[model samples]
Target: MKRFLYFLSLRTGTELIILTLLLNKISGFYGLLAILTGLHLSSLQLSMYVYSLFALALAGYLTPHLRRQSPIHVLGLAWFYVIDTVVNAVYTAAFAINWFLVIGQHHPTAVRFGHTILEPENVTSISIILMLWGLRIYFILVIMSYARSVLRQHVYSTSSSTGLYRRENPSDPDSGTSIENPFATNREDGKGWEGRLGRAMIALVRSYWLGVDEDDGWARGMGGKFRRSGEAPVTFGPMERERRRRSGTGPLPPPTSNPAGIPWATQGTK
Candidate 1:
């Protein structure tokens, strides 16, 4: 995530994505207002809003999982964001071309004509277009980087839990754990066309999606920031707890000092 987001700012990829997600949520509200105000949106623009609403619902539902740190939900949300960004850009372009043609009767859209399309003029519109696309690319990278971090961290934590249970290696190396590619495996989770699409997405950015980051000084309790008293802190969250309970490896030993990490996960670690 640092690899993708650190160039833009010191904030983690998750932090950046949260801001972008807020932007999308705000834009969705504007869309709803347009519909309610009886604005004349083209069928295409209307269709875009329909897709926007769907993405809005998904973003609303799954965005909280960022705190929950559910691998499947987080990964699903990340992929949804990527798809929405690309699709929304296409819709925007279509609307722009239609509006430009319609306005051509009053203002010239271009000075020179090409094979089928006109050359874009160096104007406010061009600058805005460039800026929007640049931001979209940055958002895409930040999202993918965060998603990969979640996947890798889940694997690492699960490995740590396993070692704590079995007592096989006190200082167990992760050499035994094969990081599962969520898009490539799992008979239930990684089947069908969605999985294929995920694989294609990963194939396009394999190194970034699967690579390790030096800034992964990830510790326990990055999440569950606002848990109520007696509720399980979502540090490793439900996934880790369920695994530990099933394995009969209960709570982690209490910290000698109440350090940064949450020693209690469910009023107890397990």
Candidate 2:
């Protein structure tokens, strides 16, 4: 959906992880449907499992959207993802056991369950299921990777507007309580271990899993720009004001433009 995609664009690091999380949400919905149709369960048990999954999937979708817009929500979202991953893995294992060990051993041939037949021995069906499970496992890794990025951004931020996890409180009353540390050596300076590990994982995933080499060509040109200097207003304003104060002189009075477009200071002459 367009609205869903708008949230995804806000991610600064681990874009693949966000993408996979979205995809996983979609797959989870489908799995929920499959559970309803393909598997047999008691009315109470089925309803409980269905409701549980529905709630979890809803949380998964909402967390990313909330965290994307507000950095303060990232930590809570990370915990949600961690719990969701474990639950999903347990559900996967349960299904795998039912499909292969129990069903395959007993019903070598396809068994009719209502309108749809459960076929555990079908080569294509099994292969498809295995592939989906493998993708799910990889997505768990993606979720962890993104969580680390969120934490890294939360722990250190150079500017309120900059970074993945931007600080929410820009106008705190005690803003001067903490000393600022600016590291402009690299575009990703002060990313800490979480960031470095996330990047390495992303690179590895891109290379081996996605079959694409990371394009570091842009890094060479971008380095100088990031490392050059902070923006003029932020870097120079305080220093210039301090210099004026030290010299016992405030800002020059407004200049008045004459008819010929020449300007003169507004100071009165004795």
Predicted structure with the largest TM-score when compared to the true one: 1
Q: How accurate is candidate 1 locally (lDDT)?
A: 0.61
Residue lDDT tens for model 1, 1-270:
366534764125655676666676566568768877788877886776677667767787877788766666777777877777778778777877766665564555443323114435525675788798898777777776667777666544443332312222337865232334556665344688767766676666555555444543343334433333564444465887887878989776555775555545554454
Model 1: worst 10 consecutive residues (lDDT sum): 159-168
Q: RMSD to native for every prediction?
A: 13.2, 13.6
**lDDT by residue for model 2 (22-77), tens:** 56556545555766577765564455466465655656655655446333244335
C-alpha lDDT of all candidate models, in order: 0.61, 0.46
- Residue 32, candidate 2: how far off, in angstroms? 11
Q: Evaluated with lDDT, which candidate comes out highest? A: 1
Off by over 4 Å in 2: 1-40, 43-54, 57-61, 101-126, 141-269
Write down the TM-score for model 2. Answer: 0.38
lDDT of 2 at 7: 62
Q: Which stretches of candidate 1 lie over 4 Å from their true place?
A: 1-13, 108-122, 160-178, 181-270
Clash pairs detected, candidate 2: none
What is the C-alpha RMSD, rounded to one decimal, of candidate 2?
A: 13.6
